[model samples]
Target: MDKLGIYAVPAIIAAIVVFGAVKRIDLFEAFREGAKEGISSLISIAPSLIGLVIAVNMLSASGFFDIAAALLSPVCNAIGFPAELLPLGLIRPVSGSGSFAVLSSVLEKYGPDSIIGKTASVMAGSTETTFYAVAVYYGSVGIRKTRWTIPCALAADLTGMLFAVWTVRLFS
Candidate 1:
């Protein structure tokens, strides 16, 4: 005969619920209170989320991203990455989802085997979501210290980009 204790989990939960109700602790009330607290936090963070969306949209529309890519193209080509992935390097520092979309477009256009597409895929894996960092650091402390952040984050993004292209080209 095979022993079965598989039903014990639900039995234990039932016992706990019974004990709590008998003790006069209202479980539904407690759950509602916790959910209300979570909603309050979401409301508090709403402004920051909206600001992030607007800023990312503006950056994309400005054409500054393309200018950045063009400016960095020479250095990118020198570092063994295809010049086309320069926009990906620019995008990665500004927005994660945006960069992912750009990477997908590149892959679809060129196919993943092409140097540009492969380099972009590698860079996407290697880099951090830089705009999220700024939003978090600024939004948490209310710093608004936008001066030094962009340069520092861009430097880190560039380093990751170079490393990604180099490593991918070397190994693959």
Candidate 2:
């Protein structure tokens, strides 16, 4: 089974090459065209993505999230939310990488089997990077006025993070 996994990708690639040859399609040209389209899409989305990433990094570096987490910790803890997991929950919607860094820190400090770590992991898996997705997909298509999309997506992300805490507590 382990060997099967190793060979699967090569087998798939070989099959594709043979199929392309049989159909007399120019595989190299097809690959180049696909790459071109991908690059064009990247170019369209890059500016918004870069700005989002920079903003996230700036907020993180300025300790804004840390302060926010500290301020919200009491409210969170009263409702059975782990005070330590507040940062991960707060950042998960805005930036995937930022939330991942928070998750990693949680795992390191609390260990993976600990309730805080488990909740962080679950939240990371359950929530989407709402701002990142809005910036990428919406910006790619040139949609500037995301009136309701941001609000709705953020609400969904908050729901997911809350459920992650509840589910982990329930199962653990």
Top candidate by lDDT: 2
Model 1, position 104, has a per-residue lDDT of 65
Per-residue lDDT of model 1, residues 44-65, tens digit only: 7667556655664565578765
Q: In candidate 2, what are the lDDT values of residues 9-36, reduced to their tens digit?
A: 9999999989999999999999899999
lDDT of each: 0.74, 0.80
How well does candidate 1 score on lDDT at residue 78?
A: 72
Q: Which residue runs of candidate 2 sit more than 4 Å off their true CA positions?
A: 1-71
- Checking candidate 1 for backbone clashes, the offending pairs are none
Against the true structure, candidate 1 reaches a TM-score of 0.52
lDDT at 131, model 2: 85
Of candidate 1, the 10-residue stretch with the lowest lDDT total is 1-10
Q: Best candidate per TM-score, number?
A: 2
Please state the error at residue 154 of candidate 1 in Å: 2.4
